[model samples]
Target: MANVNEPTTNYVILTPEGVLHGFSQVEPSEQQLALQAMLAPEQTMTAHEWVERYSEIWLDMFIEEGWVEVVDKAIIAPHVQLDDFLRYVSASLSGSRRVAIGSDEGFCLAKMGFTQQEADTLCVAAADFFDFLKRQQQRGWAVHGHAISFFSTIDMLMPNTSFIFLWINNQGYWIIIEDEPLLNNRAFVELVWGIKATGERFNLLAEQVLDKKAQLESDQQAQAEEQKK
Candidate 1:
């Protein structure tokens, strides 16, 4: 673990293709896992707080990674600036404990906690996903009905602001902000490890400040009734 003196670098890959998506009862072998991604610190970013982090820090990372380019004042949220897409990829699922990862080639698993190794793994995953998004853009695929727009090359013409692109899955996506505040504190969702948009499991987001599921269930039930009618 980096001898305690250096800043602890942990790897938190929010993907299910790892060594642990299946085999619920058994842990996969190390060779199947990204040993560098051990566990992330057990903290979550509250919905609004997550936005704050994006504005303050992560927005820059997204820019550096080619995920987004500061566009206009976030027409969505005033305090939160707007970001246009550079590349997009999405998928979804939620549930926690343990990290599993793999591509078409293989898979492995890691426990969810905090460690330098986990951070390193996350770093690699972040970089890989960034590249993946770029590839998807070049292919001219319409992701969520929108085409990719690379903003990194035109920073001189466009102002930089903090914004986040999100994750989507077979189900939907995880979002904390809406036109209206969902909670008394205005914190709809929180990401302990920053933003849990990896589309893997909700484990990273389950630890929450507000229970939005109650509303989700109600919406589902209402939709079911309407369908029957």
Candidate 2:
């Protein structure tokens, strides 16, 4: 049996052949097992089964360690910013035709080997398609209710390019490549979680600023009233 008090070593590697390998000194817990099952190509457990087996405490630890993020009562996978996340994605999808990051508001944050105008156009198309998907769900056409991640091979906007779309918080990311997709890749999953965590941090900072401004305005109003009295 492994010593409970002794430190354990865990490592993950992405081989040049694109195979992912992971190892741990200690046996995985039920939660870890459940997560692994969910990550499998032929997922072993349903969402409900996975939820039942998953541990909230484990999730809390991931959040505390900045591996996961919570935003507006929803969880965004991996905690990372736009720039760093893009870098990781770019490296993972090396030699891709184009890789772009954008928001639902038709704003392109960054792109590789593409003009700003082209990026913007792609973002708009993604946003429109996302909206259309939601509308279809509302119309009962989508029996699965909603999807957190999806892809499109038909490039209606950009010719000769296929793209994958991932939604992180209120933002969207696009990876345009010929035949490779990052939807199930470890790097892509990390990008999603990291971006969500970044968004949460920004929201908290904005809230603090707004609260401080409100307090200052109240203090000034009190001082003026006292002087008038």
Candidate 3:
């Protein structure tokens, strides 16, 4: 990583179009400066490696909650430690997507070519949760029909990390949370489809998978019980 304050050494960027070189300038615009930082990994990582890095972190979250399974498949043996995976997929997928991280610190997304495995894993998860989300939606979770485009999901790839994403349309809005995937298998789905969730690892994992209706119902029940006391 090069300091923005000083000149960055020669670097490359893996963009949606293709791999590109950075432009040398006496004073790069603010956007170019920011872009240099965003493309940091490309200076070292190939497109496939970048996607693998992101997927590994995202999968680790699910692994913690027993939502996913991992087979080493390494020629030698188990190579995946917390930081290292023994065998890595050699090919990068054809499509491109942006993965960004958010917190009090700030926000950043990696622009890279995604792998097929990465796309499949998320698609499967999103489809699974979409079933539950559709059920809740019919019961008035969203505006009944907001014409939302289910493009791609941006998982907040940090453990015990909390993030807020707001989607606004002509009809209404949705506040989606993507926390560690311990609540339920559908957590990845919910996070993918922009469903409301209590992304709290402190609570029982079962209790954490509350759709909008479930969450509201639980709140009402708690309020009623409190009144009785």
What is the per-residue lDDT of model 3 for residues 1-229, given as tens digits with 9 covering 90 to 100?
7576993333122232111111122234433333233233112223234334455453344345443333222111121221111012111111112222221122122112324454334334434444555577679775322112342346634432222222211111221122331322322222222211222222336555656669899999999999999
Sort by TM-score, best first: 2, 1, 3
Give the number of the best model, judged by lDDT: 2
Q: Order of candidates by lDDT, top first? A: 2, 3, 1
Error of 3 at 37 (Å): 30
* Cα TM-score per model: 0.21, 0.53, 0.18
Q: Candidate 2 — worst ten consecutive residues by lDDT sum?
A: 16-25
User: What tens digits encode model 2's per-residue C-alpha lDDT throughout 1-229?
Assistant: 8788985432221211111111110244444333333332221233334445666566455445443322222222445456556665765653453567666556777676567788778777767766776687678884231223333545443234455454443345544443243444556555444544566667888999999999999999999999999
Query: In model 3, what are the clashing residue pairs, if there are any?
Result: 79-86, 80-85, 80-86, 93-115
What is candidate 1's lDDT per residue for 1-229, written digit by digit as tens? 4576874332122222221221111133332222112212333223233334334354344335433223222212112111111001111111121222222111112212214465345434434544555587679853332111223345544311111123322221112111121112111122211222233335446644135777788899999999999
Clashes of 1: 39
Q: List the RMSD of every prediction in angstroms.
A: 20.5, 11.6, 22.8
Off by more than 4 A, model 1: 1-94, 98-114, 145-188, 192-229
**Model 2 residue 198 distance off true place after TM-score fit, in angstroms:** 2.5
- Against the reference, the lDDT scores of all candidates come to 0.28, 0.49, 0.30
Better of 2 and 3 by lDDT: 2
Candidate 3 is scored at a TM of: 0.18
> TM-score winner among the candidates?
2
